[model samples]
Target: MPLRPSRDVFITCAVTGAGDTTSRSDKVPVTPHEIADAAVEAARAGAAIAHIHVRDPKTGRPSRDLELYREVVEKIRASGVDVVLNLTAGAGGDLVLGSPEAPLPPDPAGTDMAGAGERLAHVAALLPEICTLDCGTMNFGEGDYVMTNTPAMLKAMAARIRELGVRPEIEIFDTGHLVLAKWLKDQGLIADPVMVQLCMGIPWGAPDDLGSLLAMTANLPDDWTFSAFSIGRNQLPYAGLALAAGGNIRVGLEDNIWLKKGVLASNGDLVERAVAIAEAMGSRVMTPGEVREKLKLERRW
Candidate 1:
């Protein structure tokens, strides 16, 4: 894909992800109040959207508690921040197997598989403007674990999301994932002007390189709206890269924990840095209202 150099771009700040990062950094928000506060702060720092995932307040472990999500959404809504809310429907599909010899019985502690409706309980309840649909399954990290989202599962989840009148942000971890997203669109499971998030540089997934980014973007449908992001050190660079590629940008603690080496970053700090990068490249950072208009989002709250 050519570098189109967008004049105006929107930023999505993934406030807190369903990851084990809380143990590594003190800034990771674990409680609902903390997550809501971080999301509002990111919006104030010029993020058009807040991609949120809640964790167990006491244990700091990723959770699928509907109450937790409800609290977070309620708090953010009450704060009156004009930010698009994109909730995660990517949890509850973690499949951790036992040793190769004992793979038949999955690891009880690490495995968390749920039905489509169960996984989307919170999204169905809160009716956020947007929710994510992880496009495909993959070996998530260095382990016997697999992030399992079968085709049937995805179809069901996408149908429910559409029925609820919420836009599904198709999250692609690799080229194949993008292909699957297109297939879903063709099947009419996904709506028009699809929104995609090209997630790069996670273990066992697409590398965060210019060539890889270009390949992913090049394959996207012309009418689709997209954003691209990479994790850790590559996060900041991808901000300018995505804007230059005529796409939007995403940044936050969910993807990276640092503002720089040896420094932990808050969600606001990441959004602030992304805003600077976009502006330096002569691109204007868009507001939530602008993004909602562009994406045709129906804000249920």
Candidate 2:
């Protein structure tokens, strides 16, 4: 049977992703207040969830500060937005290696590693409905840098998230990531009703092509919740594709800035547009409460 269409789909606004996008667009929120406001605005624009990453208020670069994340969560709650808080647990470890000759110490200019416990400190306190856990490590790009996350590190983080009663949005950048993710499930490191985010088109990782997407999708457990997104220009377009593929969509400046060439967008603008796109396709956008039920998530208790 064709998968029945639901009245509404779920929208996750990746409010303030920890990328270098701030350098390109002034509209990207910097301070915690600004980030929280962006999230609230996304909620008002019909986003059911806010996938978040914090930054140093001064530089707007990504930061793993627990205090900053706390403020964002508290402000959103105080404002009474029904958005599900999906705090990021992908920070703390970024290892940049030196030339092939010297690999032991890593290049100081490119390395940003952290203790596993410290890496997930924010999620521990906030206990958001969802948090991201990158499943595998990869040579990030041509640069002398790498986004390092070993199997041991992933298991450690997943264990903690499970203990804290937080849902881990397994982020798989490639087919191998899915391999490790499934293994994690088999090992009972994560619970059933598994959730994953198929990260496509990330440089030096997964290409944003249909084959790559299908390969990852094929490996997902027969029954699991999933969402998908691409960076830069493909962000919104892929949202529709993800929905059509029997998955959810993720959008926001964390992945893209311009609504079009030469036009910068606010988080709300992009979210409102996603609602229109999804609805136009005869698909319904789910609310946060609806997502809670669909994922069997326990709300703040």
Candidate 3:
């Protein structure tokens, strides 16, 4: 496909992901207060949206606790920052199996599978302007762990998110995930003005090459709004790549811990770098209000 490029782009700062990154970087937010502060800082740094994931305050491990989410949302709202909130509804589907010789029984400590209601409990309660819907199940990273999101689960979650009036950002890790996204749309589970997030450069999934990224974007429906990101070092470069591919950008410590070769980055630092990249490409970084208008989001404090 040709390089259409996005003239008007929006940046989504993924504040803290459900990854084991805290050990590597001290900038990763753990408590709700810290996470909320990081999100607000990112918004102030020119991010239109804040894609958030909560962690256990004590252990620094990812948590889906309703109260943690509640505190984070309340803090962000009370901060009076005008940034779109996009929560992660992609948790509770972690499936970690045993050894290859004994794969029947899954590892309890690493596996965390839940029903549709439980998986989307935080989203339904908070009703953020946007929540992610991971479109497919895949082997995530170097482990026996598989990110498990069955078809039935995705359909049910999509229906619920639509009913809640919160837009579901279809997260695609591979080209096949786009197939499931279309299937959800065909089943009427997903609504119009669809938004997608192209996740690249993960093991056993799509590579972070330009050709692969172009292929993924080419398969997307023309009417759908989209953003793209790759993990670690490529995260910053993908900001420009996303704009060149005619999609928005996503960045933060969640996807990348380093701002430069040996520098640990805060969420604000990442957002600042992304803004610079977008502006240098002659693309306008959109504001939160503009994004809400474009996506037709419903904001509730």
The number of clashing residue pairs in each candidate reads 0, 6, 0
Tens digits of lDDT, candidate 2, 52-137? 99899988778889999999889988897788889888786788777788777887765779978898888888788988899998
- The deviation in Å at residue 116 for candidate 1 is 0.6
Segments in model 1 whose C-alpha atoms lie over 4 Å from true places: none
Tell me the whole-model lDDT of each prediction, alpha carbons only. 0.92, 0.85, 0.94
Residue 116 CA error for candidate 2 (Å)?
Answer: 2.0
Residue range 238-293, candidate 1, lDDT tens digits: 99889988899999999899999999999999999999999999999888989989
Candidate 2, TM-score vs. the true structure? Answer: 0.95
- Tens digits of per-residue lDDT, candidate 3, 1-301, equal 6779899999999999999999999999999999999999999999999999999999998899999999999999999889999999988989999988998799998888999999899998999999999999999777699999989899889999999999999999999999999999998899889999999998889999999999998888999999999999999999999999999999998899999999999999999999999999999999999999999997786
Best first by lDDT, ranked: 3, 1, 2
Tell me model 2's lDDT, rounded to 2 decimals. 0.85
Ranking the candidates on TM-score from highest down gives: 3, 1, 2
Question: Which segments of model 3 are wrong by more than 4 Å?
Answer: none
Candidate 1: which pairs clash?
A: none
TM-score for candidate 3: 0.99
Displacement of the residue 148 alpha carbon in candidate 1, Å: 0.6
